[model samples]
Structure formats: C-alpha cells, structure tokens
Target: MNNFVKTTVLGGLIFLTPIVLVVAIVGKGFSLVHGLAKPALQVLSVETVLGAATIHIVSVVLLVLLCFLAGLYSRTAGAGRLGNWLEKRLLEKIPTYPLLKAKLRSALQPEQLETLQPIMVRFDDSWQFALLVEQVKPDASLVFLPGAPDAWSGSVCIVSGDRVEPLDVSVQRIIQLMKRLGEGAAPDLSQLRFGAHEA
Candidate 1:
C-alpha cells in the first residue's frame, strides 16, 4: 500500500509539471500585455477609435514604437552606460543573481581562458567523457558541466591543466555535439591531429 501510494504520487507529478509550467508562462504573458496596454489605452482614449480592432492596432503600434526608441537610446553613448548601470543594479538586487552570474560566466568564458592546460578524463569514471579546463596556482577555476534542461544546474568540479587532455576542437563543434549527444559524449579528436614530423 505504501509503495502504491508513492508510485501514484510520482506519476501525478510527472503529468502535472508541464501543465503547471505552461499555465505559469501564459499568466505571466497576459499580465505583461495588460500592464503595457492599460496605461497606453487610458492616455490615448480608446473610445475615440473606430472599434476594438482600431484600439488593438494603435496599442500594438505604440508598443513597437516604444521598443524601437528604447533600443535606439540604449545604443547611444550616454544612454548605453545608463542602461548598463540600471541592469547591473537590478541584477544585484535579485536573490538569484549570484547563481545566474556564476553559471553564465562559466559557459561564456573565452577559449583563451582555458589555455593553462587540458586533460582528458573519463568524467566521473563513467561512459561520459569531458575535456577539463586546468587552473593555475593559487587561483583555481571551476567548470560547470551543463546537464539536460537547465544548463545552470550542473556538476561543479575543480580541475587543473595537467589533468585534462586538450582536444583540438572548435567551441562551436563542441556545442553542436553536446546538443546532439549530451554531456555523456566526447567529440572524435583523432581525425584533427596533424601529421607526425619525419626524423
């Protein structure tokens, strides 16, 4: 009876999670549209327009215009700094900023940053293999290997250059392979090796 109850609960959650997420997304989108439309319609007096169609058209046009102007302003010298400052301040206030920043920093770091040393390891001694980025000296580096669905929530490992074998592979190719076969797979680097020098 206890096992039956647990199985039922697990199955219910598996079915309900996607439905819950979709409903949440729809609610958020509706709220955003309402926020944008309410103030614009109040100021413009939608009653003056021919009908509902006219009101919707005007609202959409206004929204597009506002977005375009905002984009243009952000690109300007003075506005660019202000926009960046505002974004940074907003991100700092969020509770999840540190977690998000750490994940993003790991994924987006330049290839040059990984130049210390590379190692090839049977990651976790499982079928999955990965090219580990090596850290130098007192300053250690953390590589967050992304998992399925949420890339941010992955295994974090402290690794150094001497332990990892560097693969002569482009970042794009690695990303493509990851997307196809996931973190369990490694790209075939043997084909990419240069010819041996004759004695």
Candidate 2:
C-alpha cells in the first residue's frame, strides 16, 4: 500500500510538472506583454473609443506582432549571434529556459521536427516504434525509442540500417499517438513496407 501510494504520487507529479511550468510561463509572458501595451493603449485612448474588452484584443495583436518581428530578427546573421549570446549569458542561467526553449522549438519549428523521423526498428521477431536520429555508419543507425504516454522521455539505440523502417507520418502525429497509448496507430502503421521487403 505504501509503495503503491508513493508510485502514484510520483507519477502524478511527473505528469503535472510540465503542464504547470508551461502555464506559469505563458501567464507571466502575457502579463508582461499586457503591461507593455497598457501605455500605448492609454495614448491611443482605445478604451474610450472601443471599450475595455478591445484593449485586451489589441494587446494580444501587439504580442503576436512582437513575436513575428522577433522571429524575423532572429533569422538574421547578426541577430542570431546576439540571440545566442543572450541565451548563453542570460537565458541559460534560468534552469527551465533551456528545456522550455527546446520543447517550444521542436513543437513550433518544422525543420527541427523533420530531424526526428518516425520509424519502426526491428528487435528480433518484433518491431518497435522509434524516432530515427541519424545514420552513424553505412549499416548502423542511431534511433530513439520513446517511452509510451511520455514521448519526450526515451532511450537511444544503435541498430542496423536494414532494421529501421521509416514511417510515412509526421513527428507530431507519432507523438500524439504515443500519448494516446497506441489507441489509433492502425492507420499510420498500415503503410508499413515490411511485406515488400519480405517478398
């Protein structure tokens, strides 16, 4: 009974920690942006013209525009260096920032998401779902075997190239399927090329 209780509590904590952290970060960011937009709202007298509700919408628009501008700037060579320097000197000092940034990047960036390819890795008679990291040699490939229900946590394995079968699915789709505990994997796995190889 004691072991069960302890295990359950730890599981709950692991599940809730990411959610709580994301919520806290989002709330803080919105508050900061809203504060910055307040002075502009006062100068424009938007409250007098459109009422209080529109001010919140305007703040959200400003926040989105700010993000767009930052994205553009970050793409530039000079801005990229500056951003890296700021991350190294300031942002990295905050423990959660690096993890949060990586998660956000993988979620938002198409190029980054493309690097983690969904695949099936052979293990004796059975094949396992995995993400292909890269080919270390002509015949050996490095892959990540993600834990079910928690796609981010996983182990890396080096297996023969022939043992890896690329799946025709998006990284996000695979992650969602994993989070659903393999409930809706049939449609995705239906396209497997194993039969062709066997013949």
Q: All candidates' TM-scores?
A: 0.46, 0.69
Encode model 2's per-residue lDDT on 20-130: one tens digit a residue.
888887678778888888888788766555577776887788777887998898889999899899999998886556545656776787578788889999787677889
Candidate 2 clashes between residue pairs 3 or more apart in a chain or in different chains: none
**Candidate 1 has which clashing residue pairs, if any?**
118-164, 118-165, 119-164, 119-165, 120-164, 120-165, 134-160, 134-161, 135-160
Query: Candidate 2: deviation at residue 9, Å?
Result: 4.1
lDDT against true structure, model 2: 0.79
Model 1, residue 179: distance off in Å is 4.8
Model 1 lDDT tens row, 27-102: 6655566678867787877675466665566655665676678778867999978867976878567544554554
| RMSD value for candidate 1 | 8.2
Worst 10 residues of 2 by lDDT: 190-199
Best by TM-score: 2
